[model samples]
Target: MTRLRLAGLLLTAAPLALALPAAGQAQPAPNRTLRVAPHADLRTLDPVFGSIVITRMHGLMIYETLFAWDSKLQPHPQMVESVSTSEDGLAWRFRLRDGLRFHDGQTVTTRDVIASLKRWMARDTVGLKLAEYTAGLEAEDERSFTLKLRKPTGMVPFALGSAVGQIPVIMRESDAATDPMKPVTETIGSGPFRFNRAEWRSGARVVYDRNADYVPRAEPADGLAGGRVVKLDRVEWTIMPDPATAAAALQTGEIDIWEQPGQDLIPVLSRSRDVRVERYSSLPNQGMLRPNHLYPPFNDPRARLALAYATDQADFLAAGFGDEQWWKRCGSYFVCGSPNGTEAGAAPYAKPDLETARRLLAESGYKGEKLVLNSSYDIAPIGRMAEVAAESLKKIGMNVEVQFADWGTVTTRQQNRNPVDQGGWNLFVTTASGATMQSPITNIGTNMACERAWAGWPCDAEAERLRNAVVEAVDEPARKAATEALHRRLAEVQPYRVLGQYDQPYARRVNISGVLEAPVMVFWNIEKK
Candidate 1:
């Protein structure tokens, strides 16, 4: 499976010199430590439990997957030595590579891979679908495993090589044996870096030491796959909630990289000759306004549709990205320019009309109920979207209460299902990469299964049926038709509001090299000169 390609829109600015140390100033050697200011703090270490962006980066540092998606979105063997299927298509065999050792000096075994897959399939949507066809998953020998399916399904390799948040990463048998719902306390893997557990401080800083015993693949680096090379002896990730502070730190050479820089600070960073700003992925980050379907106002389909129709994409786009070149007004539920993106049956959200929203709210019997909107001040995009949404809702005559917190806190609070007065939320802002939204199988946020739905808990039988159809589709045309039909139903059901799509850039020192332009941020091939 080739990696999905996104738009070619990119932003790169010439570097300008900032006042700095004189020539006499002694500079530290650049071959050891590489400090970075990530987008968010590391709140959770477990990859499955920590589905956020920051933790996903941490997962890449410590863990290694059997098969990983390349720059073309194609799956390549990583830990696995080879994979072959029987002529009957009922059984698939996998062999592990030699000389693979965990952090604790244990050999990577087929039993460990089987244990890891069992845990990942419990929560991941692709894993659940694969489980439906899988009759048994067991170790064939110490170095190999076999997956027996009740019927032919060609999705096993793709599911195992998922590039999104819920990646099927391998672990030691002891750690992999833990309950899927529970968080693993131990961090041990055979990746290029080993977690320095003693140096870890929750919400503050985390450190990783280069693995001396690890060996890289002979193939060159390509996206998430290929060689795992670590040039730096130590990598440090420090948490800085304020964008201005992070930019200042980067300017002073205190930090080597800033994962997600604020759009407003791009000009300031551009003035510094030491920093270089570039978009890592071609896919833009999509803004989303998710409403809790279990509560009032949004529970009514009319009320939800009103919010979507009342939202002006231009307003949200400007607020979040500010520049026309950095953002695009995407009217479709799926990404606008992607293969699966379509505007079918999307007449209601073409324009924003305050009068239409007011009428819909009145028909839903809304009596000025307070809508709790969670805003994350730490992330510029999320905060800006929430602010614009609050003002838009007020114009429609709805009571709005904005709750401000950090990104991690907002992520934690959005999962609560309690009543509004009991610490529950009514609305929140989130963003997804275009790669995650390109197809129904990868887009977990759109799941509408009754009690097993994603965050907002939308229960739409028609949408669920359409989502399944897309997954079971035989080819591209069939999948496209199902996706188009899903979009038509989504417009009427109004599970969530799409707040346009925008691009984000990463700022790093000019001396750093070997940075791959991939969706997920990986530090393996990166080297600081």
Candidate 2:
């Protein structure tokens, strides 16, 4: 079951020991503080520790990657100004922007990048997705570097586009090798936001100031440059998990913004004249559903497949949330509109067929045994989903037991001990970040193949084999064949059950500005509307 380690975090309303009295109708905005209610706080600030997507989104504030994803979702240069690969496609050269500087006053250099990339390759399996594509990288000049691949792999840059691939911050090699957790506590990057301070107990309310020295500009000839700059002087993410309490604080002007209010409260919050609810499209998969590979029953693919029969995904859409628009459909792992996704359709793995499910239950050695469901996310929606699924599974002869988990219990990658491994719940549901961008390598590496992460089911050789073929096969037809084969196998094995993707909800005061669909809400874009 998915654990939302910080979902229930309370938005404690302490008396404004430091309060600025509200003026009549409108007030001039000083630097603003937005109180967002993330279902779970991020597991760690260590980008290398968690999923690439989480790290990359976090990196936007404290670090910079080589490439960036454009509004159209195509790859564009970021740190590196212009890149040219060898005609053989085995070697590539990058011309880094000159004069890029870190918040620590260190000018960005090629040596820093080589050190950072080596560090990421050492620990981050997701980052290794890029490693698998390239043999090695060497610094050429103060602003130039070269990457040598094993073969004519044109997909190198495209592959980096996967989660953290879009951005790889170059760090001083000496500094990176010194700290196991680099850039988290003491970090340096050439991005817009500079990390100030972070403490976990006070609920991870990190303070970040702007990186004023960053001077990477896109020339008109190069076609992409001058990213939207940070407009705010100070940004703080106050830890808040309880939706109602967060909404209450936002209403009273305690914080400038919050996000993902419960459906029940959407109406009540929407009626407030002082606030604005901004919704953006989420990734293609509904929240991720992990069937316990550690548990004996779930170890069997038949059991996993039968479990899929328990939930009526169609009904989940109708009743998944109070706001129908919040639950939407996605075609593939990458966001629906990217280069990898196909047309959306009903998930074959989610169709509810009690008779077939009953047969699977019998074959999987369950006459009516108690099966525990583990979850740490918002109980309302998942509880609703479970209740419906329980009734359906009952028709197929399963004694399913429902239980609760602290939303933050799952691996935040900040620390160890995954809740799915300890909670004994057979099913875990939560949103998976970053892998959706595409690097056939990053997309499937850990989500399904990494044995350490999925304890119950050791790494599947065939899964990796199929996935690798897709990533390495330069020929389009072969790549398609490999990907299609993997999906068909996934449907049969049921490693994960997708409910369908949903929307991202950002609730801010009417005067607050700068809400983009980016995974992490950008602070620089914020100003009073």
Candidate 3:
């Protein structure tokens, strides 16, 4: 069933190419250029420095990983020719596949892989945990590397194969040598596509040309794993901040795909029989509200709890997902309906009471403190949620200000950990794929490691301890107990709020094919007629 209600908004015609028949049905122009309008601009291509879906998508295009997970959620070797573990399980060795070479014509060696893993471990949440267990990692040969662990862990493969944000993308040793905290400016990898730097323009357009030297695995493509064969000669991403403009472009075939069509504009695109609207993945993107824990009114747990009470899940859900059927009022911090999902700390969110919120705020001594709510309308759903949150905050007698920017701008600013007065943010609206939030280990926002924590810089000793327990839990029951405990603690601390959960839709010309049903966008199997 379609999830959008009829929104009375006029559509404007935009200049775009002509539409071709559906994939395998008709031939496109002689020049095969796959035009795309992604959800946001490609602000940062360095996957280690950014966790946004757009950045991950970019990384998938120009970079390759040693291992990748398939649709069944099983890890498969991508660049690795083979892998083996010692009897004690404390040592693991991986051999690189033959013919693996970076775009610069350099072989992908064990030294490069070790350097990339080291840089990634210094940043990613899963990488940090992996580092803690890793006693030593060194190249054993030109093509093979070994990781000596302090303890036996079954998560080694999963960690290396993870396709979530902050993915451990392999790169040239020289490029990987860049500081983990800084972005790697060069775009060189063993992936099937090479960045067309000459045609790059920030906030305008980015292009990728198919790598003729790339070789595909014998296996069929599935999710981020298996064979990655680029059928198109080139893929160009045109950043259109305005949904109407992007929708028009897709309709006119000016672009081959619209990665994330705004919810409000979905109805307009639906009216076009020539256009096809498809959900990105089976897992939905969850709406979230992350609060700055360094200072505030929010630094106090009571104040954060007041904000949670101030929020009405129904309002945020309705704003983000127009139709009620498309979204859920997920009270748990974890993605509801997942294996470890529980209602442990959902009591306060059961019913929003402004009166209780007022009492809590008074108790916390909040003195009309101003909160800057950074919102990006480039994606309508996020902007709408922020608007709703701002109104709710204002109703509770707190000063709320909504700052406008594109999704890229918000992501860049969220990296700043300065005081709110010095261009820092109080809270921001964004979404996380349910695939990434499936566990405490993969979820970045769940970490409470003080200065090293995710963007919010939250610190909760109990939460951190519970997170570690979840990691160490061996049995299903024990993992469930640990997750429930952590969920309850998160509810009590309120480092971040799960506003709602909804799916993001993508629109493309009928001719486009091979859009994977994976959690992250994969352009490998796609082809244009």
Candidate 4:
């Protein structure tokens, strides 16, 4: 299986800087330690719990998977020595390197890999990546293991390489046995760094100290980290929720990096030599408003259509983002111009045509009824998008209303037949969406599934079936065809209106390197300048 690919999880923090530093600075640069500050807290240190921070900084430091991406985003061995598949495509064999050691002075073996797979199979929110591809997994010897599949799953390796990869990121056999999502002693991994202390001092400041034994593939510049091979002894992560505070810290070197700086400050950052701002309108970060198909108003296809038509996505973008392009106008479910995209949703829903909206409203039997929308954050700049949509419907002769609430409240309301005024949110955005594709799916299908698995309201059984087939089928044409079917259904239903994906900038010192271009920020290529 591939590594897990994350799409807009709000999990990781710290900004990125790809530009090189000044030529003649008298102030020396640090060799090993790289300082970073993110606005979110480290909710948990366990790899299984899956925080974005852990995925970014700590993933490379602590965990080593079967295969990893090199500087060019190409696959290379990290944990496993080599990879090969059986002719039937149901079994996979990995040759391991000898004498690999964990941070705790323990030797890595095949048992640890099998144990981690079992844990993911048992406790992961999604099914194990390589499970259906394999009937079971077992260690044959110290350096060998065989994975037997239930059926012919050709995408297993691709799955293993991604964030939600089929080949699970191997963990200590002991640590794999515990349930750390419940907050147990599951903070151990064989990465470059270990979990020190997760202190939510102000909002939340999670700090990590260097591992003395951590020696990277590249040689260290100095022994500043002391007896510990780490160049920097410690890494401090401060949760600066306020964009202003985050930017200030970066400017003053109080924080080496700041993730998620406000767009309003882009102009200020661009003019400064110390900071470099890089943001593209086309990014994997997209906003989507999904409705619960199992619930009222939404259950009616026409009502759902009414909501889709009434939403002026252009206005939503204009009001909230100022001058940024419509985040990105996606044709398919994924980011615009991404692999597997089908030009499915490029055109916005016909301008909140009150006449069309009203007709659908009446057909749906909702007359002058106020519709409510629940959201975790403030959604609209000019009147709530939900309210704007509702008003548009009203102009068409259907009364509607939109309401905002916490994520928990919105999710709960979406689950039941909640009121149109209170927690009844007919529309809401998805903070995270699991892409079901076998290899990598975040850029291709952020909200909808590329493979099998049901998500969101009024699930699509056909979509689910097609997704599954894509993952199982060996033929490339067959998989892509299934992707087309899924998109067609989405267009017909128009689940939540998807604003295009947009690139987010990470502010870093000019000297930093290897900030990932994909939504899933991996550190394999990251190195000090």
TM-score of each: 0.90, 0.78, 0.92, 0.73
lDDT (tens digit, per residue) of candidate 4 on 102-185 = 877888888887777676554332333345455788788988998788876544443444443222457888777676334234
Candidate that would win on TM-score: 3
Better of 1 and 4 by lDDT: 1
Q: Can you rank all candidates by lDDT, best first?
A: 3, 1, 2, 4
Model 1 lDDT vs. the true structure? 0.78
lDDT of 1 by residue, 1-529 (tens): 1221211100001111111112111112235789999888887787865566776788889988887767655566777776777776678787777778899999998889999988877766556667767899989788899889897655666667777756788888888898887778788988888899899887789899888788767666788877777778889999888888899999998999998898889988988899999988877768888899998888898899889877998898898887788998886776877667787787768789788888998898888988899988777778888899999999988899999987778887766788878988999888887766655666666767755566778889899888767666655667678888988988888778888788888999888877787767788778887
Model 4, residue 367: C-alpha shift (Å): 7.5
Of candidate 2, the 10-residue stretch with the lowest lDDT total is 10-19
lDDT of each: 0.78, 0.56, 0.81, 0.51
- What lDDT score goes with residue 249 in model 3? 90
**Candidate 2 lDDT over residue span 362-462, tens digit each:** 78875565766654444356656656555656677777666655544444321322443453556545554333433345443224554433323325667
Measured by TM-score, how close is model 2 to the native structure?
0.78
Deviation in angstroms for 473 in model 3? 2.2
Write down the TM-score for model 1.
Answer: 0.90
